[model samples]
Target: MRTDRELTPAELDAFGAELDALRERTLADLGAADARYIRRVRAAVRLCCTAGRVLLMFGWFPPTWLLGTLLLGLGKILENMELGHNVMHGQYDWMNDPELNGQRYEWDIVGPADFWRHTHNHLHHTYTNVIGRDDDIGYGLLRLFPEQRWKPFYRRQVLWATLQALLFQYAVAVQHVKLDKYFKGRISKDEVRPLQRQMNGKIVRQWAKDYLFFPLLALLIGANALAVLTGNLVANLLRNLWTFAVIFCGHFTEKAAVFPAEVLENESRGHWYLRQLRGSSNLEGGPLFHILTGNLSHQIEHHLYPDIPARRYAEMAREVRQIAARYGQEYNTGRMSRQIATVFRRIWVYRKPQAV
Candidate 1:
């Protein structure tokens, strides 16, 4: 529980105004270049998907099978991270392209797009790292910070964390259901049924598309059904693992802070900005690495300006660091490997109950 210097009311106001000004500048600058970049990302996604599927149909060849799997995995990552996630954030909605409509755009994951908008765009963003309010805090399954109450179940959090990463999308799919409450009799079964039904429908559709339809189509076309099935499985696994790693590193790093619920009481805009900064970390990477991570490599900036097009984060990060420094705030960031290691260390260190 590292402490941040509490800003005085006037200082908080000034700090917030500066950040709001930066956001305005970035938003005003959004135009042809931003559109071109996202369009290019969409083009790359389509190319990877189409080519990967075509190659997988010839998966009898070892080289082709390997290539196809990697290509398909890349495609899923691009779609999930760069295209789908950003578009669904309404980043490109200003361009007036119906295809990029945040509310209507559906991603390729088993979790429904509508569910994500509520769980992520609304709750997580609004609550960031507030212990009770943010569904993302340990994702209601593990204790990554000492501020969360320890439970016997959290003793094996390292194991739970690993399993969650491997099946990350499914974990995301069930997040909105709040099964913990159901088990404790907080919510009734009837209330849970509709959400469960929606989740189940999404799972069935996703599984059928990847596991059945694609494989069966390959079989009918005289290709190896087994190969197609395995390729899709491996590709999805890759997307899940990568996505889990990137997201976890961004939020659960050693320096990231979780807030007490009381902090929300009459919190000013500057205090909110400060909380977002302290609770998020950034990963340092090359341009391609940033793109693949949806520029969440600049997670600090993303938290600060979640609605701003992520492609603009890299540039915004430089100014943000300077602003943070002037405000005497620490800007947390590190290499992906370093940040990932920190998250793992947090998981292990907080696995046991904290001493009084």
Candidate 2:
């Protein structure tokens, strides 16, 4: 059923062994550099956010306002991508820093860390691209792959994808809600009430911080309250758009593969590794770009070694590519522009039933 060449049982064992050895080597090497790197990233996030807010207080000046918005957006991106996401992955837990504890760390996004742990950390990572299990397939909205059953609703997915990118955080926030199942009457409102309450509380807190609290603070200072509010709005919008693009490009690029439920049956470690390699794509970029992506630009490595500190992914990628080549598996990767274009094309092409 697979279009790509399959590894024999012995080859699969060797492939898994190689990857496991790489992971152990990386884990053993985690030390002061890794700790310092994450700490520095955290410091950068705070610096960007605070300085951006300070600049926004004088938003009467257009240049200051524009600079403030960009800086603030950059901070949120660093937090959402570099700091928050990786920390919540337990990537820095070995540092023994309570602040970096994955189970307890809360992110700046509207999605509760606990909810995300359930939907993303556990479910999405575990099921990955399995058709029925991974809700990330289209986030219960757009039809990104031909394997998904086509619906009349998907005709508008091109537009939906755009809006989803704009409001990406909100889409992530409500992912665990499974609204589609609720709408289909498979899950009752009573069953969803507890989760709804949790979702609403987080949404309100995030809104208050960005939309109300900061703007009100500016008003008290006799600054342009409207400017502050608008800046925050635009900043969140920037974060949404960028996060959406980086993430969509990672998983939905043209060559990325999806599998069925049965593949999980007695799936060997090597087979799981193979599935991760095939199902994920990487973005080619330099250090700054990689950091901004939480090193998820190395999506293949992240999928293979979910627990290893992501800061090491770039160097680790060289070995990973070689291993894939030796096993006759393609390591899906491309420049950001090329990958994202294919993702959009896939979205457009798969909106129809049996389009190919």
Candidate 3:
């Protein structure tokens, strides 16, 4: 079987058509019972994480503020890595209840889902690595190495990519919000609903509770204000760094392909999916890594079927790879350390080409 690059346009189209048919047939064969089980497990994991946060915030078993804050950060990291991503993809909708389905977007527990949907589903899924179009490129920060032509700084150092990843959430959030405003001609009423809804008494109450009430209570109860503040900040920084690093390695690593805008624009769904597989790799082994990182190890499968539960992703990956092999596409995968190293190298040496 010839590789993706070896296939001509006509050959690529033919392969895509066959894969589309196969995907439909496979989805039709999925058992409702299995889907339900997957959903139940997803819900259970989410609930456990939520409970852990509540315990960290309110339980009296441990009086250490630092430990409590660290636990809270860990809880958030676990939820985001596992339940949050799957829920956004609607993988937990086996209940068939509209309310339950919509609960995935309840931002109070999981952060804003709309932002994720816009970036992940609307843009990244469609464009993959299409330079200016794919939001995953630099997560809206520095230019992806392949997209950077004249940035001398990026060409000099890839370790800076790690620094970019450290601040990815803020960069992504700001960029998406601004870009949506710019392209859509104005902010839609729907887009601001989340912020507006939070402007009510709930915001006031949360502000008082988290900032005024909690901190004062901690100080009044004989805890050192400086220690508690420093500890909480450290925990948050560590959590965010870990989360961002994992995400960067998933897409920005060496095995990941960076496509030119022209090529990406002309690609079909099959081509885009194939590109995602080639660009992203599964990190092998480490049961703890799989659990904590949400089995994002089956990244290609997740990209192919974002709505499939993560727990089932590993099993589904084998079948998906078999299909890819039949169609002559190579499935990319590697160890976590190798992937991390690749990310650093790619970031260090990445630069856009000069315009003609």
Q: Every model's Cα RMSD, please? A: 1.2, 1.2, 5.3
- Give Cα distance to truth, residue 233, candidate 3, Å: 3.0
- Give the Cα error of residue 9 in candidate 2, in Å: 1.8
Task: Please provide TM-scores, in order, for all candidate models, with all chains considered together.
Answer: 0.98, 0.98, 0.74
lDDT, candidate 2, 165-277, per-residue tens? 99999999888888889999999999888998999999999999999999999999999899999999999999999999999987899999999999999999999899899
* lDDT for each residue of candidate 3 in 15-91, tens digit (9 for 90 to 100): 66765665566566567765675455456555653443344444344554445666655655565666566666676
What lDDT does each candidate get? 0.92, 0.92, 0.60
Clashes per model (N, Cα, C within 3 A): 0, 0, 10
Tens-digit lDDT track of model 1 for 95-210: 99999999999999999898999999999988999999998999988888888999999889989999999999999999988788899999999988899999999999999999
Judged by lDDT relative to the true structure, which candidate is superior, 1 or 3? 1
Worst 10 residues of 1 by lDDT: 1-10
With candidate 3 superimposed using the best TM-score fit, by how many Å does residue 79's alpha carbon deviate from the native?
Answer: 1.6
Off by over 4 Å in 1: 1-3
